[model samples]
Target chain A: MSANVKQKRTLLEWVRGYTGQKYITTVLFLLIPIVLLTLFTLIPAVNMVIFSFQERDQLGVNPKWIGLDNYVTLFTDPTYLSTFKNCIYYFFGSFIQLALALLIATILCSKIKFGNLFKGILFFPYMMNGVAVSLIFRRFFQKGDGITNSEGTLNTILALFGLDPVKWLSTPGLVNVCLVFASIWRYIGFDIIMFIGAIQSISPDVYEAADLDGANGWQRFWYIVFPSIRSIVALQLVLAIKGAASVFEIPYIITGGRNDTSTFVIKTIDTAFVYKKVGLGSAMAIVLLLIILIITGIQKLCFRERK
Target chain B: MAENKHYFDLKDYTFKETPKSVRILFQVLKYAFLVVCCLVVIIPLIIVLFGSLKTHDEYIQSNVFALPAVPQFSNYVTAFNQGNVLRGLFNTMIILVISCFGTIITGTMTAFVVQRFNMMFTKVVKAIFLIVALLPSISMQVTVFQIVNKLGLYDNMAAPIIMYIGTDIIAIQIFIQFLDNISVSLDESAILDGCSYPRVYWSIILPMLRPAIATVLVIKFVGIYNDFYTAQLYMPSPKNAVVSTALYTFVGPYGAKWEIIFAGIIICIIPTLVIFLALQKSIYSNLVSGSVKE
Candidate 1:
């Protein structure tokens, strides 16, 4: 009995030693990511919050604390707040993109020939550099100089259809629509890929049962597919909302945020870099961050209650 | 049923017993939608290809879709030289290589440690990553810019490289999920054989992580390569131009020569398109697994 007890004690000691060694390895391995994360993400995030409350006079100089002044300007300034209205165009565009992506993804996940080829072609845009896409679409929507008699790709197609050419990028009201349209084209591929993945993950047995039960196509989709992929849809909804609010590249590259097509992010970047209003730009960024956080929080609560 | 075990194949039977007319109509509509989407995607790309070969006179005289009378291969050469695309490609390659290596190492290590060890510290690290991911990284760029400047990393390639390595939440998630799939007994067996935990990780864990690494590497490469904002903001110098920024050089306030810009766009697109086509299968599945596993 004593011998057995002694062996047990030794085994217990060995297990303790194993755990101690494991903990040491964990700390050692975690060192680099922790250090880098702190230096880059944590420190910068804290400094951003501080910068939002301070005023900077010059580049490379220290900023002075000006409590609530930057926040006050952001709320009161018409020029600053007006850019957020542009997000509405993109917000609505994102929903349209989501719906189309869902439809296409669902179809692709079904009995379609050339499904792989179609997916490849559709997803190719997401792989292309954003700047390249912006440039391509810029030419796509070019307004013809009547003197030169040259028309943009879209207008030429319109002319072919016996419809008069429309000023795609020049008209103030229509320009955001064009910009949002481009945004959808670039991003809808991502949504399709994501939705297709979600749709495909549904087990075939489930579908087989639905088929045996004489479930029609629409019935199967509405009852089974919709519920199955609802989580991804919810997650993507939040992502789409954030993306719309913070849209920067398409409009920034195509229009350079000119002609009232500036989104919140472009305006913030310009305010900080172009206009040298660092404090105000930081405040704008913080506001945008808060808005995103609130949206995410609401989504979580809504999802939880539904579940 | 044996041959058609894939989910898509299983879906075909559901349509089989339906009335033939409705089935045919649905099939046609599906093809129609797909074909239209494909055309919409391909047309803009085709126009760029056509425009790149056209002469200045031809571009101005013809509509956007008209094919070039003669292919001007020299336009690519001109864009190559004038747009500084070669230099940009070189710089982007440098950033891609270092950042990919760093992200894989740091991401895998964090995943291995956190998932294998059940501890309060591990929980905290996981929570930290989740919170950071939720916080919009773009909105905080203003302060990151200041930090980069203060650290004297402005206009330095290391600036973007470090940021890319550090800010990879998706990579960590991918790694963690992969580690979870790996049996813990493998590590324990190695440990039982008098191997240290680090040894177990190196010999057993790292080898098993090949698929995950490939997924992470491909995803990281594409993301870092296509990134224009970080490359533009941090390293704005002509000498420091990456592929995306190099293309931006052609943009002017007045009308740019469209042919050359089109050439530049083509040059930037070919590398990614080739990669995508070659790894199309794995890329799709890996992206799906990584994302949905989250």
Candidate 2:
């Protein structure tokens, strides 16, 4: 072979040593996923941050790069302001939902038979299509039809005890109340599973020692179990809140953004596609992203301190 | 005799004939609680079944929990009448099949690179993984919507297929944990033997990744099967809808046809249920096995 041929072969051989075919394979596998993430996730995120400050004209294509004009509009807009207020209202459910799930998980974990079976059953709702569940609720919540007339599950059971029916779906604030129920139904199992796994990771020996010292059931729980799984609790709380705030499918499909259920997510979609104000919608999403980031950063700090 | 009887005091006694009735009472309570909990889980499913039998007018007259006065199975036929259920099913299957394979392959490769390779920019790569994990799904939604819309893939299944593979950090994270259990000595031996890293991975490491592979496959399959959000956002056109979306269309914005909605819901549930039942053991045990460890 010529010297040039030898040199090329040697270079190929060296590349082979450093990375082998794995490097090329690695690059190939990472290519599509990375490109998609960069274009869709990273670039869009940057555009959103930029768009939130800009104003768009009638055509809705070009952003006129106004100085926080969109943000100014956001504060003045009733739909925007009300939904933002409702966002805080929505946050209350997250706390209760997580707490409720955590409580059930705790009870079930404390020597319940077929804990795995129970956990599986509880998580069944999570597997459901959110839209499907929402439809079920819509009928169940129909004014004077399901709840008041005892046609829905809750009202039927209540009526059996000789109580009046409730117009569950038609009630103003009850929409959120039903959302909590739906959320709690779907997520309680997940919270329990996560907590159970974390709680189970605590050695039985610690509980046994506490028992030997005559620590009561509640005492053992507080002193021994609580401190042990603090980190896991922090993780669960953060994830649960994150899940709740991002909720769109249930409200969108079930209620169709009616009855005060138009959350940040619902309105964001509307502002973009429905209202044809893509720039404004993108700006709103950017604000949401910032809120999520701040919350996550706080959670990390909390978790770190917990450790 | 009295002293001897006192020795057999209450502290040392098992359930006696005197407490036998109480024992039975407690046993009944146990079963009752168990049944109630199970009822809570299955009630929604039962309602869906009974609701589907109601005629559109009956659905309006009766509450959701009311028994169907007439058991009409034609709601299912009605559900089919709205659109081509079979076509949507086919489209969903195609998207699922492609994405399932893509997720498995790409997920495995990413995990392998992050765990096995010690590149100069390992820190940067690892940081990216954390960012993906820590970020909320909605945080990424805006960007995805704008770009996918701009690229003119809004009505296509390709968007979700790509998203599944791209955002699948959990499977990779799980695989990394599994890989940690594997001794690195085998890879070292392969290197000494002049086997390339790709060759080593494919021939040696990939075989060991079977358990992780099974976990990722089963979990992702279930996720895509029941997925509504991505399908709704990206594939809004009716013809391209998945089962989840097809069911939603039946219950359109104006008024829901309960019978058809129920039929669609039941139809959607059966596939996932059968798959889950067959692999319940693996799914249950996979979650239990060394996840979230320090």
Candidate 3:
């Protein structure tokens, strides 16, 4: 009887050891990722807010505590304010992109021939390197001498039509237009893909019913498809708007933000890296973050209410 | 089928309610629009291809759409030699391999531990990950720059690798979703057979996660390969240039030679084009799944 009791105690200890080991395993597995996140993402996020408050010449140089000045400058300064206004061009452009994507997605889902081929060709550009695409467009929109303008592809086409070679890059009025076009070309494919998925998910019974009821294609699309994909549309719009506010690579590479074409992000990067105004740059970043956060918060509220 | 036969099975009906002329017009319009869109997308690529093969004077004097008199394949050689294309590709490959593997391991381990354990700490961790996903990564990059510099990892490949591995929320989400489908009985039975938790995870749980891993691998590979901002910012030196940044050598404030730049662009585009063609189907499905999950 004593031996049985001892065996029970030993078994209890073994089970206890097993539980303890599992706990250790959990901690061990989580330890590196958590530490990395804290070091990289979490700390930087908090420090960004902190840096927005302090005035620093460089990133970590001699710093003076100047609360709200950087933010004040960010808000009141005309140079910075103009960049935020520049997003309007992209904001408007995104609506056009979404509309086009929706139209094409509807067509593609309607048993169209060569649908896969069309999609593959259209989406190929999205997979290319951003810098390379920017380079391609840079050559594509180059200004050419009117008499023998043979280099710029767009200009060459214009020349073919007996039209004058317009300065696509140098003109301030047209530069933003050109930038918006590039943004659309790179992103419309993504919007198309998303819309196609949403459209395909709609049940066929609804379409069948619409057909049997003598409804035309337009009526079917208007009453059924559009309303069904409203959530996806809303989500894509939110993302596109968010993307508009942070338009960076295309302008940064194509025009290098010259000729009043700087977006908010390019301005932020220039302020920090080029001008060495780390504090002001941090404040600009915070403002950008606030804009994005507000947008996402609104989206969450809209989604919750619908539910 | 018999019940629906009397109800007029509209699903199999070959006829549409729309008028014939309207249907024809719609079909014509759809084809016209698709053909035009496809041309608009393909024409630029064609221009690049043609321009890449032309001599310098041919590129300048001839129309952008004109065929080169001689297909100057040497332009590619010039681009490869002068642009440091090989080194850029090699550096990008290194970064891609290390970061992708690191992400998979860390992401899977975190998912396994969180899903297996019903602890408060795990719940908080999950919440933090979700919130971080909502946070805009670009806005916080200002401070990230400073931190990396402070860590003395400036201009090093390790900087981007670590950031890529750490900042991935999508992989964790994918893994967690995948883990939910996996039966806990596998782990339990192994445990009952004297298998330790880590052993069960390594031997059983890891093998079951192959599909999720492939999805993450493709997404992460394409993202890391095509990334310009991080590589351009972190790995700025010519020796450390990535495929994206390597093309930057040909173009800048000063005017560039269009032919060589075109050659470099083509050189950079080939790898991704090949990968896309090879994994086209999986990529489309994976992207849709990832976005829907998000």
TM-score of model number 2: 0.87
Per-residue C-alpha lDDT of model 2 across residues A1-307, encoded as one tens digit per residue = 6999999998898777655465676686567667766776677667777666666532446667778777878778877757755555556777876676656566555544575676677766665656667776665555444322336666766777999878776688877778666656665655666666666667766766865786655566678777887777776667656666677766777677788877888888787767767667777887777777788989878767855
Which of 1 and 2 is ahead in DockQ?
A: 1
Candidate 2 residue lDDT tens string, B1-294: 222211111111223344676655654554566567668778877888887788877876776677898798887776666645666678878988898788777777777777887775544675677676655565356556767777777788888888887777777787778888888999889888988777777887889999888877766776787678788778888878887787777765425455677777777776667766677667655654523531
Of the two candidates 1 and 2, the one with more favorable TM-score, higher being better, is 1
Report residue B90 deviation for candidate 1 (angstroms): 1.4
Score residue A165 of candidate 2 by CA lDDT.
76
In the range B198-257, model 1's lDDT, one tens digit per residue, is: 888888888899999998887887788888889889999999999999998788621457
Worst ten-residue run, lDDT, model 2 chain B?
B4-13
List the DockQ of the predictions in order. Answer: 0.55, 0.30, 0.46
Cα misplacement distance, residue B279 of candidate 2 (Å)? 2.8
What ranges in model 1 sit over 4 Å off?
A: A1-20, A57-62, A146-149, B2-23, B253-255
TM-score of the second chain of model 1 compared to its true counterpart: 0.92
Which residue pairs does candidate 2 place in steric collision? Answer: A141-A169, A148-A165, A151-B63
DockQ of candidate 2?
A: 0.30
Candidate RMSDs in Å, in order, are 4.5, 5.7, 4.1
Residue pairs with clashing backbones, model 3: none
TM-score of each: 0.93, 0.87, 0.92
For model 3, what TM-score does chain A reach?
0.92
